[model samples]
Target: MYTLHYDSPLGGILLAADEAGLTGLWFEGEKYFANILGPEQQERETPALQRTKRWLDVYFSGREPDFTPPLHPVGSPFRRAVWELLLQIPYGQTTTYGALAQQLAAKQGKTRMSAQAVGGAVGHNEISIIIPCHRVVGTSGSLTGYAGGIEKKVRLLQLEHVDMSRFFVPTKGTAI
Candidate 1:
């Protein structure tokens, strides 16, 4: 695994890649920091890393990026499915966990899928901003359960200029 560090408004972000493409990006001190790469990881700015940095630069400047870097996040089949759906979330929009579960259920031809299960998969996304796990909210429009911390999530939404009034930090649950 090859890694590089990017300085963003949020703080230092660690970017990792391999022969396939960009694999992981985690904020400093996030809950799953470097969860995908092993100790054999090396620090090198590959083309993928450079592209990811440029993408971050545009995104942090409050402009929607025109392209997405090649992403090759490592995860189970279920997590991959959830992450793929996360990527479809528009730049300044948010969706509920229950809504995502319903979509996944429809895709899988099942009657129902649990919102909690979708939340677990969303929480485990290896690529943060690029895959857009932060766009997932609770059914009640509560900002909840971001592995990178809710403060960063809020800032990311603000960066995208998402309407803050539509979402709230839950008073009695994991949002705190």
Candidate 2:
């Protein structure tokens, strides 16, 4: 295991990578990552990890980045689908967790997705803003569970130019 930390508007996030690719982006990294690393782990240079940080910088600046690097995502199939779908969420939009689950479910001819399940998956995303999980909101337009924190979610959405007026509107058709 190899690791390093970088600053983000959300705080310092720790990144880890192996030969497989960059594996995780952990918020409030120093304590979180330190606990998980095995003693044999060393700090190694990862161009992929570095590139991910650079892309995060672009995202914080409100410009979507073109991330073509290898991402070693660890999750169940449904979770992977949710994370990939997050990528399709154009930079300046928000979608409700139910809406996202419904959208994903439509691919398989069903309209059932548990907000709890999707929320759990989103919470564990190894990649954050670059993948845009921050775009997912409560069905009521409430900023809900974000591993990075709801305030960070608000900041990210604000940076993406999502109007503040929609911040807490929970109409039935409200997006994520």
Candidate 3:
């Protein structure tokens, strides 16, 4: 894998690539990913660095990622399916994890999955903002469990012009 560091308006970002194109993106440092993967990502994530960095440049600039470049996010088949489904989500729209799981379950003839599973897939995505996982929210429109932290998730949502205030859960039993 090839790796590169990208400095965005928010912070320093890490990119990982391989023969598969792009593999991972982390706002945390190599040390953080290394802790997660049990080896240094920078040591292995050295192949798709150039292309991934370029792709990120386009995304942060507000253009949609062409996604023509190679990508290799590692996860369970179900998680991969979830991630692939996430790709179909448009640039500025949102969906609930329950809704996504329901959409997939509809094809398999039973509602076998739960929103938490979808949330797991969303949380484990190695690629960030570009994959547009920020578009997924709680059924109640609350943002939850972003690997990049709520602040960054809010920033990304705002980047797409999604009003952060609209997502805050109201006080207990407050009227609409």
The CA lDDT of each predicted structure is: 0.91, 0.72, 0.71
Per-residue alpha-carbon lDDT of candidate 3 for residues 1-176, written as tens digits (9 for 90 to 100): 56767898779887766666677778874223522343554544343666676777787787777664567877788888889888888877788899889977886688567878787888778887667677888888777767676667777877777766669643443111
How does model 1 score by TM-score?
0.97
Poorly placed runs, candidate 1 (over 4 Å): none
TM-score of each: 0.97, 0.83, 0.82
Quick one: how many clashes does candidate 1 have? 0
lDDT of 2 at 7: 80
Model 2, TM vs. native? 0.83
Per-residue lDDT of candidate 2, residues 37-115 (tens digit): 5577667667887787787788777786776457777668988888888878888888888878787778758768776
Report lDDT (Cα) of residue 19, candidate 2.
77
Candidate 3 has a TM-score of: 0.82
The candidate that achieves the highest lDDT relative to the unseen native structure: 1
